[model samples]
Target: MVDERTRYFRRLRRLRNSARRWSVMGGGLAAAAAVLTPYAGIGLADAAWAAAAGASVALAGWRWRDHKALAALPAPPPPDPALAGQRLVAAVERFPAGRTVVHELRRQRTRYALRGSAVAQAWDRLDRAAGTLSALAGRLTGPGEAAVLEAAVAERWLRDLGQRVASVERAIPLSPVDQRPVLASSHDSLAGQFTEGVTAYERLVAAAAGYVAEDGQPVVDERHPTLTRLIEATDRMRGIAEGLSELRRHPAV
Candidate 1:
């Protein structure tokens, strides 16, 4: 992906070019009108002057707004990648969910100091979670669904899931031969927990679709059965995140 920041700067450049083009056009029009006015008869002269004034105002005003907007946004980030931990930074950018999740994980990794494998593992879980969320979202709003899922509620679930996934991955550490099973168990549990939540979302969506197909759409709120089940599922995932947080804090030696 081109990334949002890159696209943002591209937009600014396009707008700047447009502003420059208009400014040049306005200046030229005003000058042309000014010169023509002197050679015109009384009525024509007045019309030419008005045209010049209008053109000047139009272009000049556009250019002013352009400059103001350009100045309004934060200055472009340091060009390309920064030097410190540049490889890790680049790897973080490769995350499907984007930099925010990875960055936060790294920030929380004060103890483990895990690197390569950590990145690989975290990327995998997060990538799968993102795809799962997208699929769940599509099902939630699919044509046959009884009701649309609220964007705010969906966002809340996503935020909680993503943060928990990151924290869990960050907490998982590399182990020697003996500790491999322990690590495997942790991985399996985390994977299962994630899968369970996804299954829950699918269950809810399918149930809603079937019911709506038969009885038609019903009023949905937090109290709605299907909606409440979703909330319960998401809460289960939140509970897992909390448990993972505690595990990270008191990891076995």
Candidate 2:
């Protein structure tokens, strides 16, 4: 059965086709009327010619105006490699020294290096998934066939990755060493940051999906508020993830 989303897209396509057809039909009818006016009578012929000329001018003007409007619409920005890198760095910084999570992550990292442990493998998968997302985001600027394909692929990948991240985040245990008030606070802060990052990442993924649905055209309706949010969220998520990853690699004694 056709899904609701498929039906919606079909409806949009129909509407666009209908509009174009009507515009052409209207222009053609006006031109025909102008032609018929001259044939009606000699006295009316001059007036008919003038009317025809006016109709032609009006049609041309309308088309020109429509073209200009489309041309004036802004395109979406390209992905920023530097910004993506910075986000990763920021995420890494969120993990402070002497934290239980950091120590645990560090142990896993060592095991992965020595024996390719499952925990290490999971972390590596997450890193790879994040990298895929970043690569997809970078290619979202152009309006070519490749860009459209990339957007679609990215949308699918983001959805899958978001789910995976959520699963991992949920499975993470709270730090067991929160005996001291300071440690407890830090633990809470770290958890909150990670959760926020995941939410932001999901939002970015959703935005990408919407962008693909719109056929990569920058619609003027909301002016792509989602896209703006996506950028901000991406940075936030990257920073948080990077900090956590860094803690895994280099934990405090």
Candidate 2 clash pair list: 87-238, 87-239, 90-239, 91-239, 91-240, 91-242, 91-243, 92-242, 92-243, 93-243
Native-referenced Cα lDDT, model 2? 0.54
On residues 1-33, what C-alpha lDDT tens digit does candidate 2 reach at each position? 334445555555555555565566657766666
- lDDT of candidate 1 at residue 246, scale 0 to 100: 97
Look at candidate 1 and give me any clashing residue pairs: none
lDDT of 2 at 233: 96
Cα lDDT listed for each candidate = 0.59, 0.54
C-alpha RMSD of each candidate structure in angstroms? 23.5, 28.1
Score residue 180 of candidate 2 by CA lDDT.
49
Best by the lDDT measure: 1
Query: What tens-digit string does per-residue lDDT give for candidate 1 at 1-253?
Result: 3545676778777777777777777777767666666553647666766676677668767766976787698865643554535666677788777587875575456224434432334434444444444455444544533344443354346445545554665455555668767766775675565555555555555655564454545555426678779999999999999999999999988
Candidate 1 Cα errors over 4 Å, as ranges: 39-41, 45-49, 75-253
Q: How high a TM-score does candidate 2 get?
A: 0.23
For model 1 the TM-score comes to 0.29
